[model samples]
Target: MLKQFGCTKFATGEDFDTGELFVQFEHRGRMVSLIASSKGYAAAWLKENPYNNRRKGTKADHEAKALEKGGTAVYSILRDWVKGQVTAIEIGMLSFESAFLSHILLPSGKRVIEHVEEQKLLEGK
Candidate 1:
């Protein structure tokens, strides 16, 4: 299964890391997960590999690599998936990039910014 999924050992931190982009399948009474990202290294390795698996080296190394590559990949995949799902549901022109860049209105009538605002208020101006 590992070979079929193009599984490779990542030299990550603290433990062995295995990245898998998997799909759930039912087999008899049990559920099976098949690696879908075997065909796409960047998708599977970059996105799903870091957090889902154990690291092989130090935590710092794992975190560094994950922060450098994993985070971006994960964000990309998640953004794409969200876009696809929302579009499928006929949500008009919802863009992940826009949401990431600007403020968005939530269903709760609250506005959320992609990044937090840090402001200091003076007692008297």
Candidate 2:
């Protein structure tokens, strides 16, 4: 997966470790690490930092209401996939702007993520 995104050498440039999914490579002499995570993980994070039910009197409040929802958990998951520069297996109808946000340099891909922890091994279980 890392190689798919031009991340040939490990960030640490050492042998792989199972406990962590971080991979790094130099991009113009700067090190960038791609943190791979599962949809479940992002969903758990969303569940942890829930929006406080405050007065809906501000624009931030309205934005939170729309962005911070149970359904957006899937968005958070896909965002991480984009962050990691994962390959695009399928892209049904997602918009290009939505797929590659300004924060992520890699384009987004179609993934069916359902767990906080990946059940498949790096070699693909």
Candidate 3:
């Protein structure tokens, strides 16, 4: 049964030190909670790589190196999350990203996403 559901905006922007996004619900007479994006999840990532000099000095030198690091970071985070048995996730600013990443770490992609908003803003009101 559903008990609680909602996503809160970061109090101090992306400074994970402030807070995080998550959801809660009741399952089998117990409340299951999930916490996500509790830290600067994307700050260190998407940046330059300290290793792999060859990834640079190419056509997209700068961009390629950065993207490679991003991919590796994503893999690491996903793997860690799986090991920790976290029940929720937030990534790449999209629902599919969460589902796809979770699938890689969770069986059957056995994940469920519920998005809720008080007032969704749309173009032209």
Candidate 4:
């Protein structure tokens, strides 16, 4: 879907130590990156699935499995989300910038959302 809409390249990276994953793509001459944390998702999943007593695994092994599951879940979620946003852009429901503003890279070598975070732009008044 992304290639159909002016995305020329796509790549992915992962950090097992940090449980972070990122995907980078070129869209309409601009580089956009999206990031997710397997640890964060795993934490959330653990909250919902607190009881793993029936599972036979050491603590570290359980954590490792959880992180792996989280990574898979996050990937699926990101795929669906990107497809939806691309569809929205394709159908004229949104502009590319509006659809992916947060993921869009800026000249400052940071994502737009990073700048927004530095400035606390989303903070409540």
Candidate 5:
């Protein structure tokens, strides 16, 4: 079945006044060229740090814990749930705002916005 996961928008140019916008999700992604409307303004935000690099053994510990979860683990369990289905997802303006709030511009000029929203699974066809 088709599912409405979540949404995210990626700024595609240095000029914030006008640029390309990318709407992304688990099943598909879209690029909305030419951002002209003020109502849909995009603001860059910071990336979420899932792990602490300064802390030793943190990465390893997290990986080890994830492995313990096994095939039926949290990640796998979620993956298995959406194994075979025509997922149709639609992201609204709210998600776009959230994504913009979590974006950060890189030194190389590319903007990175990670993990916009918590994944939501839908059942059926």
Candidate 6:
């Protein structure tokens, strides 16, 4: 979807130990990076669909399965989201910047969301 929208560069990385993954792409001369953690998704999944002690071997086993499911789900969801957003951008319903503002990477290697979060925290002080 990104490539179809003039994204020329693409990269992906994962932390096997942490189940953290990131996808980066260059669009309209700006780099956008999005990160997701299988573990984090698993946690949320567990909350929505809690463990079934009667069907599982152990809690750990159930958690492992959830992590796998969440990992797959995250990619599928991300793909659909990117496709929809890109379509919206193409149709003039949304701008790329507004669609991916939080995922945009700055020269400092931090995401725009991180700066926005920091500013919000400072404002609360």
Which one is best on lDDT? 4
lDDT of each: 0.39, 0.40, 0.37, 0.87, 0.32, 0.85
lDDT of 6: 0.85
Counted clashes in each candidate structure: 7, 4, 0, 0, 4, 0
lDDT of 1 by residue, 1-125 (tens): 32222223211121124443433322222222222222243444546665444667775665556544644554456446534643543455644334222233334433343123322232347
Candidate 2 C-alpha lDDT tens digits along 42-119: 356546654456644564664445444523444344446655443342243554334333322332321223121244
Can you give the lDDT of residue 47 in candidate 3? Answer: 39
Q: Candidate 2 or 3, higher TM-score?
A: 3
Who is ahead in TM-score, 4 or 6? 4
Please give the RMSD to the true structure for each candidate, in Å: 17.5, 16.4, 14.5, 1.6, 16.6, 2.3
Tens digits of per-residue lDDT for model 3 on 21-122? 444333333333344552334335433333355554654565545555444554455446443433343333344234333222123222322221123333
* TM-score for each of the candidates: 0.26, 0.22, 0.30, 0.90, 0.18, 0.83
Ranking by lDDT: 4, 6, 2, 1, 3, 5
Candidate number that wins on lDDT, 2 or 6: 6
Q: Give me the candidate number with maximum TM-score.
A: 4
Instruction: Output the worst ten-in-a-row residue range by lDDT, candidate 4.
Output: 49-58
List pairs with backbone clashes in candidate 5: 1-125, 2-88, 3-88, 45-103
Candidate 5 lands at a TM-score of 0.18
User: What is candidate 4's lDDT per residue for 65-121, written digit by digit as tens?
Assistant: 778899999898888989999899889999999989898999997999999999998
lDDT of 5 by residue, 20-86 (tens): 2232233235322222221122111111223467745677674443333332233333333333221
Model 4 error, position 80 (Å): 0.4
Q: How displaced is residue 41 in candidate 4, in Å? A: 1.4
For candidate 2, the per-residue lDDT at 104 reads: 29
lDDT of 6 by residue, 4-108 (tens): 789999987777798987788999789998888888889998898777757658788888888998788777777788889899989999999999999999998
